[model samples]
Structure formats: structure tokens, C-alpha cells
Target: MDAMDVDYLNELLEQDVEIREKIKQQVSDLDKKVRVMVGILIKIHSTPTDTLPPLLDSVRPILRSCHDTSAALASLVPPNQFWRWKEMWSNSLRTAVYSAALVEYLSSGSLITLSQASEVLGIKEEWADRFSIAVEDYLHGLISLVNELSRLAVNAVTLGDYEAPLRISVFVKDIFAGFSMLNLKNDTLRRRFDSLKYDLKKIEEVVYDVSLRKLTDSTKSAVRK
Candidate 1:
């Protein structure tokens, strides 16, 4: 990367921060509303699974009412950042947005259940199909980005390659830490976690939990005891 590239990363970071702030502002009043909605969703799902059409219908107004932020997000990144690393930043932005949303989504258990996500997202109907495709496409891109980023540790850098396992560990940790940026969605964020597993989601859960602990103190859990 050149000076321009460094500038690009900085610019992108600034944009992300700005967008994060905007989202924070947007969702400011949603706390109690979102909690109530989730409670109703849980009640509806507890007994008979309410068919998705009805459920999705119930949520549609809120989803549709969401203030479109494409313009604001666009405003965050400048011409220099967008012009040069458009594709990279786009993928990064999707990763950042979804991950930001995911942190909030997961913590509050507000995410459509995986089953519901599959149900609504899998419909062959034109409207839902496109939405599903977009999310899947972005998710695949995120997976690819992680793979590429992992290889960066092995990529030749200014001096030698990133030889230190400590550095690699730090890089991995930073990736998990970035999820905390989603706290901009809600100020009083709590650490969330699940059992450690090899799957990407599971691994992230572990890190999310650990990150919360580490934030309060320097000590943390170990992979092996």
C-alpha cells in the first residue's frame, strides 16, 4: 500500500465512525420500542409458530420506517476513499454494517431466529428473494474478506512478513474487537457469548464474551486450561 492507501484506510475509518454516530442517533429512541417488539415476537413464537407473512407484516412498518441511511453512509466516505478502494471498502462497509447490526441484533435476541431468517429470506417470491440474495452475497464477501485478511499476516510488508504469532493473535483479536463498534447502536451494551466451537459464528461468540470480560479487566479466559 502507498501513502494514498494509508490515507484511504484512515478515511474509511473516519466514515465508519461517522456512520456509527448517525446510526446511534437514529436508534436513540428505539430501545424501549425494540424491547417490546422482541417480547411480542417471543410470545407469538412460543406456542404456535405464527406464519411468517403475518409476523413479517407486523414488523414491516418498523423496518420500512427505518430512516434510509444510504445517503449518510455515502457522505461518510470521501471521494478519495471511494474512488480508489471502492470494492474493498464496499465489502468492508457491508461487513461493518451487518456486524454492527448483528451485535445489536444478537444481544437483544432481536434477530429473526435462524429459522425465521431462513423462512423469510428463502422465499422464492421476487421481493424476498432479492433481499435474501443480497444478504447472502454480502455474507460470502465477508467470508472471503476474512480469508484474505488472514493471509495478510503472511503477506510481505514494509520490512519482513508479519512473523510474530503475537501479531497474528492481535490481528485476530482486533477483528473481534471491531464488533464492539456496534455499541454505538446502544450505549449500555453488554457482552454476549455462547459455547466455543470451530464454526465462525461460535468462534465469534467466544470472542464477544471474552471481549466483555477483558474490557473490565486485563485478565481473561484461556483456550486451554
Candidate 2:
């Protein structure tokens, strides 16, 4: 309308553009690092269970870099505006959460909690209101982990580590049970949760195959004796 009003609006638009560009750059960098970590972590399918600890350890520094980049991105957003620009980094953040969770699971055979995920991403307690992993993102990451574990189950069988599949089966079932208790209203999250059953089935199949094979071998040994 008036020149003063138009100038003020233009200034606001310029600031928004500048902030968006910075956030995008950080998201892009984070996405690249996440891809690298995923590439490394996926090797768990072929890697022996005994060697996995070192493999996970290799990505520790990269995970720290991810935390640094996330902090930088958070700094660029105005306080309380995190949700507004969250979409730009949401996917990357979910993948980062998944990566951290995968590493923890591989190391200890347990799920990574939200606080641990936040700690992995280097989000401080004071910044919880401004920037943190939403419950939805954490659920999405766990779903991704289930999918990965299903694949790992099949690969573990091929690698002759039948025990890993059994462990994965139990872990996946536990995660699915946890999801069963939640009232997931988000469409994407609900859909992802639906897919968990298929992962569980695949893992269960691996466990069955491993069990049958072990039983057959035991019977053969008895017959020989």
C-alpha cells in the first residue's frame, strides 16, 4: 500500500530469504554426512557381529560433525520459529536419528531413547524448547531401523551368524510392541508403523530358518553318534 509499508515488507522478505538459504545449506551438508554414515552402517548386513563394534566406532566423528552442523542450523533460526523451518531439515534430522540409533543398537542390541537421540545430535537441555527431535521423527527413525534390521536378518543368515537374526527378531518385536501402544495420528508415521509387521515377519522367517537348520544339524549329529 504505502511506500513505508512496502519497504518494511520487502525488508522482512529479504531477511526470510537469507535465513532460509543458510538453513538449506546446513541441511544439505547434514544430508551428505548422513548418507555417508548410512553407507557405512548398511555394511552391517555383510559384516560379522564381532567386527561391528569397530565399524560403528568409525562413524563416531562423523556423528559428532552432524551434531555440530545441527547446532549451527539451530542457531540460524529465530527462537520459537524452529517449527516453521523444521520441514527443511526434518528428513535429514530423522535420518541422523536413525543413524545414531543404528549405531547404538549394533553396539548394545537396544533401542536408542529420545534423550539419547537428542544427545547424539548435540541438542543441549536449554535448547529443548527451541530445537529438538519431535516424537514423530523419533518414531520414523525407529521404523527405518526396523526395516534395516529385517535386511540384516537375512544377511546374517547368509553370513552364518544365526544368533544375530534371533536377537534382531526379538528386538524388532519389542519395538513393534512399543509402537502398538502409541496413538499415532500422523498419517506418515501411521503408515510407517504399518510396515513394521512386514519387517517383523521377515525377521521371524529368518529366525525360523536358522532354528530349523540348527535342529536338523543336531539330529544329524545324533544319528552319526
Candidate 3:
């Protein structure tokens, strides 16, 4: 092309590269934070059910820090260009959503909604158009949560907490039923959803063992006596 056109194109390419680098750095930082949160939350498998509140509580500030980092990353993208650069931070954001969902599920016995995930990530209302968790990301996060809860069910049994496995089994099955109704079109998400049944099966096994052994009954009788 002409010299002037080439110069303009070159400038645009340089700007794009610069922005990509910044986004990469921000995403790296966010990934580290997500890892830290994951490390903390994964301990739930070994932790007692009653003491889980504090363990879940410990991640709040870190999640808030993640929110700050997420906001900074969002700032790096130009308005209306979030989808263009979304893949750069998609994995990290999904992990962050998983962490948030795990904390909520453990704290309460319920699933975290999309709006709640957005709140946990500190995506303010004004940033909705520019930055938000995709539905696929939220579903992926929930799938991760189900996987974790499956492991937690086995561990809870080891800890003599038979009730947890039953609770987890019901919750996960409910989630699985909900997922069954979705018309998932994304290949990766559909594949991930397919794996969820195995996790549910693991939880069911744990629940069955707990029931077969009458552990819940014994615990209840002991409490009643």
C-alpha cells in the first residue's frame, strides 16, 4: 500500500501489541491469585464440616483482590472490545468463578447464581456491557464445583461426616438435572458437562456406602440418645 497507509497500519499494530502485553501481564497476575484461592479452597476436602465456615471466610479478601485485578484487566480493553480480548482472561475468570461458587456452596448449601458470581468478582453495573462472566463460564465453574464436591463427599465420609455426602449427592444431582435441560452448543462445555455424570456417580457411591453402613443412622441415634 501507500507509505501513509503503511505507517498508520504499523502504528495500529504496535498499539495492539502493547495492549496485548499489558493484558497478558494482568491475566498472569489474576491467574496467580486464582491459584492461591484454589489452593486454599481445595483444603475443604480434608477440613471438618463445622470448621468450613472459617476456611471459606479466609478467601473473601483474596476474592476482593481478584475483583480489583479483574477490574484493572477490564480497564485495559477498549470499550466494546471485551469479546475480542476475552479469551486472554477466560480461563482465569472461569477459575475465579469456580472459586467463588465453591465458597458460596460450602458456606451455604446452594448454588451460586450468575448475578452472585458477578458480584463476587466485583463486576459493577456500569461494567456490565464491557465486562461480565459468560453463561458458559459460570456453568463451567459449577461443573468444577461438582467435581470438587464429589471428592469432598469421599473425604467427608473419611472424616465421619456421613450427612455431608447425602447433602452433596442431592445437590449435585439437582445440578445435573438442571444441566440436562440446557441446549449446550459449545463443544468444550458440552464435553465438560458430559463428565459431570461421573462426578455425580462418585457422590452417589459415597452416599450409598454411608447409607449401607448405617453411619447416618448411628450418628442420629447417638445424638438422640
Per-residue accuracy of model 1 over 111-219 as CA lDDT, tens digit each: 3332333232222223231122234334333333333333332332212322322233344445445543434332222212111112334334434544454521333
Model number with the top TM-score: 3
Give the Å error, residue 85, model 1.
15
Full-model lDDT for every candidate: 0.36, 0.87, 0.88
* Candidate that scores best on lDDT: 3
Which regions of candidate 2 deviate over 4 angstroms?
A: 215-225
Ten contiguous residues with the weakest lDDT in model 2: 214-223
For model 1, give the 10-residue run with minimal summed lDDT: 188-197
Deviation in angstroms for 49 in model 1?
2.3
Question: How do the residues 118-210 of candidate 3 rate in per-residue lDDT, one tens digit apiece?
Answer: 998888767655677888888998999898888999999898888999899889999999999999999999999999989988888888787
Judge candidate 2 against the unseen true structure and give its global Cα lDDT, from 0 to 1: 0.87
As for model 1, its CA RMSD to the true structure in angstroms is 19.0
Ranking by TM-score: 3, 2, 1
lDDT of 1: 0.36
**Candidate 3 residue 208 C-alpha distance from true site, Å:** 1.0
